[model samples]
Target: MGSITERLSKKDIEFIENQKMFFVSTAPKDGKINLSPKGLDDTFKIIDENKILWLNYFGSGNETAAHLLEDNRMTIMFCAFDGEPNILRLYCKAKAIQERDDVWEEYISHFSTKRAARQVFEVTIENVNNSCGMGVPLYDFIGQRDDLTNLYNKMSKEEHITYMKKKNLVSFDGKDTKLFED
Candidate 1:
């Protein structure tokens, strides 16, 4: 059975910080669900008991951002794959803050290093829950892949913008992400 809480406890925060990866799920009112695996150190931060921030990097699609625009509902899940069997889920309302947004600089500072940062997802926690993940299989911890960062870093500013316009501006279901729109 799972237990629900209003906010994250000290123990929960510690577990979150130690995890190497997490999953983000979102969906529009009538489109396909989007569940993405997120990794890379320093990409996620806990602002408070009821708030968290995730720095999103360039990806093949911008489903999360698009879905947030359509409906703010989002859920982030973290699993303990190498240690004790546990799972944590934060039910939240998320806002996608694009690089062009005025508050981008403020939120981006939370990350030590930035590369190909597409957006900053500000999540307002609505509910926190934990369940025994005894069924989750253990996996060895490996280092993060640097290919995505390296590819984006190699592009010039104009090229990067063009790339985003072509690739990251729309969801797979044809919803506008509004990433570059004024």
Candidate 2:
């Protein structure tokens, strides 16, 4: 059985804080769904009872930003991979904030990452679901990979932006991410 609530309780917040990784899911009105595994230090934050922030690093795809632009609905899921079997899910609407935006620095300050961020997703939680994840297999977290960050840090600022424009400006479905919009 699962319990649904309108906001995160103390227990829920604690569970989220212990999590090393989470999944972000989004979809356009009518197209492929995007589910991404997000894991990095200081990338997730609880802004309040109903708001959260996810610091998104540049990735191979920009489906999340594109989908959020088309439809704000999104879901974030965190599972206990090393402790008691529990799952926490947040159903929400989200918006993409890029570096060009005025609030970018404010949001970027929330994270500590060497990789250049592609966007910061501000998520408004509409509902929360907590459940026993009995079916999920447990895995030992060896460590966080530094390959991505190291690779990104090798490039100059301009080169990094160029890479993003070339590879992350559009989703696989051809939807524009509005990553460079004024």
Candidate 3:
């Protein structure tokens, strides 16, 4: 199928992560769908069938979290490594828990850094599929990045949310992202 999910086996998780990058796509009813290429350690967490989590770093815009606020739908994809034939995708609805929320403490602890991570979005995964990513190329894991870490560290809390309001409040398609408030 062009786009679908198959349940993940325990062994599948190890292989799925071999790829260097994964894409996260989100959108609201009438705007642009944000497909972000996420690298480094800021990616997926298979907490359980009904729960997944990802650290949303401060970026040019907070469209991803905003989209989740408007609508819980989200999709994460992992392609195969070394041109192996496999493609995995997970579909779910999400809730973005902000820094002020109590849940932030437990989830963010998994990460080594505590800079401009605005929030951790929790997903209740609905489906998982491992299709053949035979066309996907292989890549090696280099390491984590310090540049992002330093940049986020440089900004104060007020500045971070202010930046978000200006850039992330609405999806490019003119749909409201509801980035700041509940």
Candidate 4:
């Protein structure tokens, strides 16, 4: 157990900023928990107390968005490397914004990546936690994954839409994500 201050202090936020990737987890009222690892400059905005904004570049599934509609609870995690040992996790509720949303341009402008990010999730943080990550191994930062970058570059909007329609519309459990239909 840890105190909230011990969980997401300012220094802890700094540590999280250094991470190139983080895991996002969410679930609907009744379904499998969605845990997806995000990378690159897409996962972002360490906003003030009780607020977080993360960009979701194109992915194989829209589990996060789907789950959020059914339920808002979520978790974002960061594990340290090349620095002090700590594991930080933020527990919160989240809302998803589509590209058509009014604030889409405002939030998308924050990141430089050009994947035409599918959604931005604004989280209402409820608590923060930090703990000794004795088991987490230190690794050197290489760079962002170029394969994904090139993937979108090679895809046309029509093709991307088709792919999203086929893969991103539903969770593995056959639950509707409403990402494409939305």
TM-score per candidate, chains pooled: 0.96, 0.97, 0.82, 0.89
Supply the global lDDT for candidate 1.
0.91
Whole-model Cα lDDT of every candidate shown, in order: 0.91, 0.90, 0.73, 0.79
Tens-digit lDDT track for model 2 on 1-182?
A: 99999999999999999999999999999799989898988889899989998988887899999998889999999999987999899999999988888998898888877368888899999999999999889999999998988888888888889989999988999999988887
- From the highest lDDT down, the ranking of the candidates is 1, 2, 4, 3
**Which residue pairs in model 4 clash with each other?**
7-129, 7-130
Candidate 1 vs. truth: CA RMSD?
A: 1.0
Clashing pairs in 2: none
Query: Where is model 4 poorest over a 10-residue stretch in terms of lDDT?
Result: 1-10
Give per-residue lDDT, candidate 1, residue 149: 74
Cα error, residue 157 of model 1, in Å, equals: 2.4
Which candidate, 2 or 3, would have the higher TM-score against the true structure?
Answer: 2
Tell me how far the alpha carbon of residue 57 in candidate 3 is from the true structure, in angstroms, after superposition.
0.7
Model 4, TM vs. native = 0.89
lDDT of 3 by residue, 62-128 (tens): 7787677667799988776665577878887888877777777999887776677767888777788
Candidate 2 TM-score to native: 0.97
Residue by residue across 47-140, what tens digits does model 1's lDDT show?
Answer: 9999888999877899998999989999999999988899999999999998888999999999987767889999999999999999999999
RMSD, one per candidate, in order: 1.0, 1.0, 2.8, 2.0
